[model samples]
Structure formats: C-alpha cells, structure tokens
Target: MKKESKNIKKNKIVDQFEFDEFQKWKIEKEKERIKTHVPTIYGYARVSTEEQHLEPQIKQLKNSGAKKIYQEKWTGTTTKRPIFEKLISLLLSGDTLMVTKLDRFARNTQEALTTVEDLNKRGIKINILNMGYFDDSPNGKLMFTMFSAFAQFEHDLIVSRTQEGKAYAKKYDPHYKDGRPKKFTEEQVELAWELRKQGNTYKMINRKTGISIKTLQRRFNELKLKDSE
Candidate 1:
C-alpha cells in the first residue's frame, strides 16, 4: 500500500507540471499571433483651399494614436483626390481609417456611403473623431447614412443662401463686387502700372510693390484695356 501511494503521488506531480507547461505555451502562441496580425490606424486630413491650415487636424490625429497621416489642400466636393486615392489603395483588411469630421472625409453623400460600404466589406473600420467608430453593423450603416445626408444638406443650404445674398447685393449694393474683395486698392494698382511704364519688369515691380508677378501682369493689362477704351 505504501508503494502504491508513492506512485500515485508521482503521477500527480507529473500531470501538474505538464498542465503548467501547456498553459505557458498557449500564452506564448497568443502573443505571437497578436504581433503578427496587429491592425494599423491611418488618418486623413483635408482643407478646401491653400489658405486653410492643417495643423489642427494633424494634432488631433496624432493624439488619437494614428500611425500614419495623409493630408491634402484640395476641396472635398470632388472624388478625384490624388493623395486620398493613394491612401485608399494602401488600406487593407483589419485597418482603421480616421478623419476629423465627415466633411473632412467626404462632402458628397453618395461618395461617402459608397466608400464606407466598400471599407466595411473589406473588414476595415472608420473612426470620425467628432462622431465615433463606424462598422458593418446595421446601426453603424444607418447612423453613417444619416450623418452623411445631413452634411450634404448643410452644404447645399449654405450655397443657396450665398447665392441669394449675392443676388440681393448685386441689386441693392452698387459697390458690391461679384467675388472676393480686391486685396489691393486702385491707387496701389495704378502706382504699380506706373512702375511698369518706367521700364520696370514685372519681377522688379513685384519686388518694389510686394505684388506677385501674375497679379501685376493681370492688373497692368486691365489698366491698359481701360485706358484704351
């Protein structure tokens, strides 16, 4: 009986050691899998024009832990964004595409929906900082569709109001100009033209008057046409 007891005790110890080793091996395998298949988060930032700054969007994206960021100064209304296309082409399954806002990602509703659906099909996710994460779930699709439509509506409303205001101004305000206010005064333009008449090249006039060569040439030609009339 004493010999049998000893054998049982030995067997128990061996079984315990084997169980512990298997657990350790399982943990190591899980770590290896995670290392091999970790997902990447990519950020995209955009502005409508050159005058707009991208620093704010970049700062937010970095704070949100984006590994790579793509940016452009192109308008969101068009779907032919070169940088955006390159970024999209690089995205793979199990990646996240992040943007600061819906409008920053896409201005057109149909374009936004189609792009998001394609990403969803590929198992990629979208994280709009102001909104939240979106995925392939039904709720996610509904919420994204609603927000995209609302954004487009807001844009169209603003454009409609601007057109109406412009028409009213043209009718009532004789001093109103059709587009952006002139950066330079008539006096400044006339003086620049005088420098040109004194045998100063456009480059020389630009250096002296702080006007760009293109602006100088365009203004000078306009002045010449007015004088001829």
Candidate 2:
C-alpha cells in the first residue's frame, strides 16, 4: 500500500493592536481598563540609499507594536517619498505613526516642521524612538524642532564631506573616475572600433562584446572624431 504525505502550512494571525507587543504590554498593565478599540499603529521606515538596510528599523518598529509597516530605499535630500506619501494618505484621526528615528522621516527642517504640524492637526500621534512622542504641546514641538535642525545639519555635513572627498580624489588619483564607474574600458572601446572597421555590424559587435549597439556606435564615432565624449 502506497502512503500519502500531508503538507503542513503555517498561518500566524496578523497583529492588529491587541496582538501587538506594545499593546499587549499596555493591556497587561491595565487589564481591567484596556479597551479593544485601540488605534492602529503604522510604521514607516526608510534608508537614504540602495546600499543601506531596513531590517534594524523594522525590527524595532515591530517590537513597538506597529501592525503594518511601509519601507523605502531612496535619497533623503528630497521630500518626495512615495511610500511615506502613501502611508500618510492612509492615516486617519487617532492613528499612531512610528519611526525608528527622526531623520528617516524628514529631510530638511521646514519639511519636518510642516509634516509634524499637519499630523498633529489631524490628531495623529508620532512616536520617534530616539526622541519621545511628538505632540502639539510646547515642549514636544521644541524637541521636534531641535531634532529637525540637527538632521538638516547632518545632511549638510555629509554633502560637504562627499564633495571634498571627490575633489581630493580627482587631485591625487589620476585614474579616479567621477560618478559611477565606466561599464566599458578604453581597450574595449578600441577593440569595438577595430571590429567596426572590419565591416562588422553594430549588432554583431554588440553580440560578441555584450555591449549595446547604441554604445558601440557612440564609442566608434567618438574614437574616429577624436572627441572627448
């Protein structure tokens, strides 16, 4: 007799306030008074670049009772965060927003102030881990303002250091390339030109060297015209 094996599947209930750690903590503290209608806690996490990571922030947010999370890998120099924007649109009154840090939420001082102001007006509670909750109270507003200023200063310093490092590299390292490194080398370009001169079509050269036809044509023209393109 052939025996059939059964596949086991795991299903965990989604955290919806009552199932969350922070909410559970609150419930434990005030078991007699804790209500079932707690506000939803949403987490927004962001890293400045693609090279950066989001796990640590997410872990903290989950531990802090965030039922749902939105994350983004993008530059913080601009106020255009698509994920954050979407999160904001979904938030209603009496909801709580959680951030691992203040800088991950806002880029500049003005942006930070305006965003927090709007959230405060909407009766949303913002919990910044490094700093405490942001509120409409005088002290809370002051703290947020200070944190926003520091974040802006840090961003400025980073930009200054990056530019200075680039300038120094250009002055000292003759082989240093600015911006992203070149995909194809000068030797490759010369070989491509040779292939072109031998009546090889752009498509043929591209197939052989794994370079795009547009790139091969551009390099061939640049080599022939002696241009710095």
Candidate 3:
C-alpha cells in the first residue's frame, strides 16, 4: 500500500513538470510568432522637376530604418503618380510609411489629409520626417491637422497672388498668355499657311517645319480667308 502511494505521488509530480515545460515552450513560440508578423517600413520620395534633389530625401528615409523605398519625378498636383500608387498598394496593416516632408507626398492639403486618413483606416502608420513624430498618436494627429490647414492657406495665398499677377499682366500686356508660348514663329505660321494652300497635311508640315501638328492646325485656322460677300 505504501509503495503504491509513493509511485502515485511520483507520477503526479512528473506530469506537472511536463505540463510546465510545455507551457513555457508554447509561450516562447507565441513570442516568436508575434516577432515574425511585425510589419516593415516603406519610404517614398518625389521631386517635381529634374533639377530638384532627391538624394537628401532618400538619405533621410534610410536613416529612419526604412526597409523599402520608392521614388518618382512628377508634379505633386496630379494624383496619377505611378510610384505613389505603387506605395499605396504595397502597404499593409501595421506597416509604417515614411516621407521626408509633407510637400514631398502631396502638394495640397486635401490630398494629404485624404492619404493620411486612408492609411490610418488600414491600421498603417505614417511618419513625416520633419514633424518628428508618427501620425498614429494624438499629438501627431493634431499637428497634422494644423499643418494641413496651413498648407491650404498657403495654396490659397498662392492662387490669390497668381490672380493678382494675371490681372496686372492683362492691364499692361494685352497679349500675355498664361501657358506655353506658341511653337510656330510668325515666319513659320506664314509658311504653314502657304503649305496648307498647296494642300499639305498637318503631319507633313509638322515634320518639315519641326512644329507640332496642333500648332500647324492652329496656324491654318488663324489664316482661313473669309468667303467673298
């Protein structure tokens, strides 16, 4: 009877020890799983023109421990940017997206706010390098809101200045045009009209005169003779 009791106690102790070891192993496995599932950081950069520098933005992102980087040369006013779309597609929940500056990501407040809100909805974080904080925090949210307001204000100011300038220009230079200057010179316009009189296609005139087909057509329209009364 005594021997049986001792064997029973020993078995219970062995079972408990095995159960504790298994629990420890399970906890370690859970930690390893969490570590592996953590998301990576991605960086994005953009320059409006070829003359602008991109190296500084790239270097800043690298220093921030960005694992991936996407870049493009395009104006910020358009939402049809290739790399920007690519970055959006690559983001996943818990991922961090970093940019060197606000204007680097978007030229206007509405676009910037929309982008940030979209990322937030996906459980992704956005880090603006100059702001010195991640966008997921309360303070960061306030700061972003303020900054966006300022950006909108600045855009409004720019528009106002542009309108004032255009008004002044119109008063002074009646022929001032807002966009690209006409490609066809006065001589080219005359030649285009002469070619059109000889039945030359706009394409042929474009190839011959190095003027765009649209410009050639416009020149032809400008020289169309009125029908005799």
Candidate 4:
C-alpha cells in the first residue's frame, strides 16, 4: 500500500510539471504570433452621396484589425478622391490597403485595374473583404483584373441606361433642358457689370452681391459685349 501511494504522488508531480511546461510553451507561441503577424492594414471607406451610411463600413474596418482608416464622401467613379490620394501618399511597401468591396474602391474597371497595377508596382498590397481576394500574388492579380473588368461593365451599363432614360425624356418632354440654368438674374448680371465698370475687384463684387467670383467674372465678360458700343 505504501509503494502504490508513493507511485501515485510521483505521477501527479510529473503531470503537474508537464502542464507547467505546456503553459510556458503556449505563452512563447503567443508572443511569437504577436511579433511576426503584425499586419499594417489600412482601411478605406467611401460613400457615393451625402445621404448614405458610413457607420457600418467604419465598424467593419475596426472589427477587422485595421490600424489606419481613410474616408471620403465622393463617388467611386472619380480617381480624384481626397482620402484615396492621402492613402496613396502614405502607403509603403508591404502595407495592405483594405476595402469592404471592389465597388467601394472604384466604379470603372480601367481605373480600378490601373490603380491596382500602380500599387503592385510600388509593392503595396490590396485586400477586398467581400471578394475573398488579396493582391499579393500573381493569381490574385489576375483575379483582380477580372473583377475590375466586371465592375467596369456594370458601371458602363448603368451610365448607358441613364443616358437612354434622359434621351427618352428629352424627346417626349418639350420643357426639358439638358444643362444647368443660369445662376444669376438679369438684375444681378447688370449689377455685376456696373461693379466691374466702377473698377471693382471680382472679390469685392462677390462680397457685396453674394455672387461667386467666377460668376461675377463670367457676367463681366458677357456685359463687355454691350459695353463695346
């Protein structure tokens, strides 16, 4: 009975030692993971119009471990987005640019492909959360190219449909005007002309009349035709 009790105690001590060793090993593995897997993720969020929601996108980025985030209240069609420009300026090699979806990055395929190619050239990476794609490999590049082409096709189709609708409306409606109406009334234009004749600066006229400097200048040019007499 004494021998059996002694053996059981020895086994318990051995088991405890193994458990302590395992805990130490797990701690070291976790430290290694923290050191080696630190990703420099940059999040980008875009809204097509002022009325759209940005909270969901921001939350998703935060949940995804994004280290930095950029946002813009602009359409995806234009490549001149302020946040996008700022992101490009800050990007370094091995950094990842993350977006919620492909459409959030660009509306047109050419722009999307061109932007991706430029980033790849600079050794920057791209990640689209919805598409399950990353642009750090050749296969990923090819997939992105295909996806961009599809997005471009979708954008073109939407534009074409909008143009068709506008054309139909113009053909059927007699009061349809294709472009923007004049911003100023005849009285405003006349006042702008008089201000210019008095040698008033464009800024001065703009401040006094609540007219934009560009509008004041345009009106001044139009009134010059009458003044030539």
Candidate 5:
C-alpha cells in the first residue's frame, strides 16, 4: 500500500512539471503574437515655417492609424530637432515611423539616407504617405536611395537656378539689389518725398501713403542729403 502511494505521488509531480512547461510556452507564444500583430506606429509632421499649418499632415497621420505623433515648425536644413530626437529614442525595433512626405522626413539626401539606414538596421520600417512603405529589403532600399538622391538633386537644382537668375539680374539691371525686394517701391518712396516736401507731418504722410513715419523720415533725410551733395 505504501509503495502504491509513492508511485502516485511521483506521477503527480511529473504532471505538475509538464503543466508548468506548457504554461510557460503559452505565455511566450502570446507575447510573440502581440509582437507580430501590434507594432507601434509613430508619426512625424514638419513644416519649414511657422506660418505653414501642421493640421493637414496631422490629420492624414491620424487617419492612417498613427498611435502617436511628433510635429515641428522648423527649417528642414537644420540638424537639430529635439522633439524628433526624443521620438526616435522611444521607437522600438518593431515600430513604424510614418511621415506625410519625404521632404517632411528630411530636406536633403544625406540626412535621409543616413536616417533610413540606421532605422533599417534596427528593424524599424518607414511609411511615407506619398511614397508608400520602405523596409530593409533590397528593393525598398534601392527605391528609398533613389528617391533621396532625387530630392537632394531637386533642391540643389533650384538653388543653382536661383543663383544664376540673381547673377544675371545683377549684371543686367543697374537698380537690382542683391537681397530681398524692397517692401516699398521707388514710386512709393517718390510719393512720400513729394508729401514731405509739401510740409506734411510724417504722421499725416503715413496715414495717406500707408508708409511708416520712420521710413518716411529716413527717406526724406536721405533725399535732402543727396540734393545738398
């Protein structure tokens, strides 16, 4: 009778061990399932100037199921983005980084390529709303590289064209100033001068011509100096 009790106790212990192993396997499989199906999606939106609105990009990202978003009103040429850096640090290997467009991701080729490569190495995927998804796959890499190159080329071409146009203008046009166009035109300045000569107060001239009193006074003084010379 004691021998029979020992055999039953041994079987019970074995059964408990098997049960624990099965529970551990079940927990691991559950974790794997969640990891496969529920990747976190992060969105980024950016504009070059404060005047540009982030609403459109934000809305698009929301519609595309981004769980969180980072936004900025910063020039893309600059390398420092504190919020962006924070967001990048939080991203995990299975996460996806989504952006409204390539320009929003990066303004130049080198920045884009380097960022993408780093993310790819860490098993992070990128989703550009206008360009579709990109991963570490051979085809995805090729396409992303080509797109980045084109983006840089386009920006450079635009800058080169603008410089050429400015150079041509400077050579051909005697009155062309090499900076921002004047807010008030030469005709407007002439009108202000005429008003000043008629003994109008700077305040009165400002009300009449929409030019600021300071500007009118400065111009009138300059013109007086030129006449005396």
Candidate 6:
C-alpha cells in the first residue's frame, strides 16, 4: 500500500510537468543569449592618395551592417598604417573584418598570404566584397594562392611599365629632367649663394628665402662641380 501511494505521487508530478513547454522555454532562452553574444562587425577602407575617395567604400560597408569603420589614407606597399593597426588590435575571436577589396590592404602575394593566415589563426574572419569569404577550404586556399600570385604579377607589371616609360623619356627627350621639379629657381639659388658668401648662415638663408638646408647644399655642390669642370 505504501509503495502504491509513492507511485501515485510520482505520476501526479510527471503529468503536471509540461515537458514540451519546458523545452520551448529553454530553446528560446538559448537563442536570446546567442543573439546578445554575437561578435561585432567592422569595416576598413583605405586610399593610397588624396585623389582617391573613400566615400563609396564607406557607404557599402555601412550597408553591410558594420558597426564600426576605420578609414586610412596610405600606400598598400607599406605595412605601418596607424588606423589599420588600431583596427587589428580591436578585433577579437568571432569578429569579422571587411574590406572593399584585397589590393587596398596588401600589395604583394607574401603580404596577402601572411596576413590572411594570421587572421585565420586568430579566429578572425575576412570578407572581401569583390570576392567571397577568402575561401579558407582546401580549394579556397588554392584559389587565394592563385589570386595572390596574379595580384603580385599585376603590381610588377605596373612598376615595369612606369620604369620603361621613364627610361624612354630620358633617352628621347633632350630637355627631360629627372624626378620632381626644383622648388628653388636659378635666381633663388644665386641669391642664397650670395647671402652665404656674405657670411649669412644656412639658418639665415632659410629664414629669408624659405629654402631648406639640403637644397642649399645641393645647389652649392652643383656650382662648385661646374667651376671645377
């Protein structure tokens, strides 16, 4: 009789427990937690020079649901970007880093490969809008490798073309001068030289003519060499 009473009490509790309702509550709570804990999405935009604008890239990233965005104006050949560094430091596991394209971030294959590998190791995701998710799979890795090689090739070709054009100009153009135009004219140099000859120091000349010491030194060397010749 005592055992029968114990079984009745257990059945009563089981019948009232509502297992389906309990499971639904547990699942809903889990979904809420995941939603709250999702990683932040960040976007990065860069332009090599002031001539290139970043507004379009910024708009696209914003449309992609990026919470924070970083803007940088720097050449891709250099790795010392302050804004890029700051963005890298802020990234955490599960966070995604988005860029408009790959070339905006890296100039060569080695840099591209190394940087992607590093981000992979840190559990950070990279999204290239032009391509897809960088393709971390075996086939994806092969694709990235090929893409890197092509990017490097294109950069090398550009450099070669620029150099070839410059060389041709130098050979054919009688009045071709190298590099940028001189900031100081012949008259300015002569005035600076006269000031120097009259005991005015480089500092004094710089103050009066706004020409740098290095420029003065170069002009003086050219004049001295011409005299000797």
Best by TM-score: 1
Query: Taking the tens digit of each residue's C-alpha lDDT, what string does model 5 give over 1-229?
Result: 9999999999999999999999999989867865776668999998888889999999999999899999988887687888888888767788999998898888777788888889989888999999999887899889998998888888899989999999999999999988766679879999889987888988889999999888787777888899899
The residue-by-residue lDDT of candidate 1 on 185-215, one tens digit each, is 9999999998888999988889999999988
Ten residues in a row with the worst lDDT in model 3?
A: 220-229
Candidate 2 per-residue lDDT, tens place, 1-229, comes to 1222222111133334336977778667655433434678999999988988899999999999999999999886665889999999767778999999888878788888888999999999999988878999999889888889988898899899999999999999999988987689999988888888899988889889988988887777878788564
In candidate 1, the residue pairs with backbone N, CA or C atoms under 3 Å apart (3 or more residues apart, or in different chains) clash, namely none
Writing each residue's lDDT as its tens digit, candidate 6 over 1-229 gives 9999999999888877878679889889867765676698899999998789999999999998888999989976676889988898767779899988878667778888888888888888888888768746688678878888987898889999999989999999999888888988999999999999999999999999999999999998898898799
Per-candidate TM-scores read: 0.81, 0.65, 0.59, 0.56, 0.62, 0.62
Each prediction's number of clashing residue pairs: 0, 0, 0, 0, 0, 0
The lDDT values for all models are: 0.90, 0.85, 0.82, 0.82, 0.88, 0.86
* Weakest ten-residue segment in model 6 by summed lDDT: 29-38
If both were scored by TM-score, which would come out higher, candidate 2 or candidate 3? 2
**Per-residue lDDT of model 4, residues 57-116, tens digit only:** 989988987788898899754657887888887676678888898888877667777788
Error of 1 at 74 (Å): 0.7
Against the true structure, candidate 1 reaches a TM-score of: 0.81
| CA shift of 228, model 4, Å | 20
Between prediction 3 and prediction 5, the one with superior TM-score is 5
Best by lDDT: 1
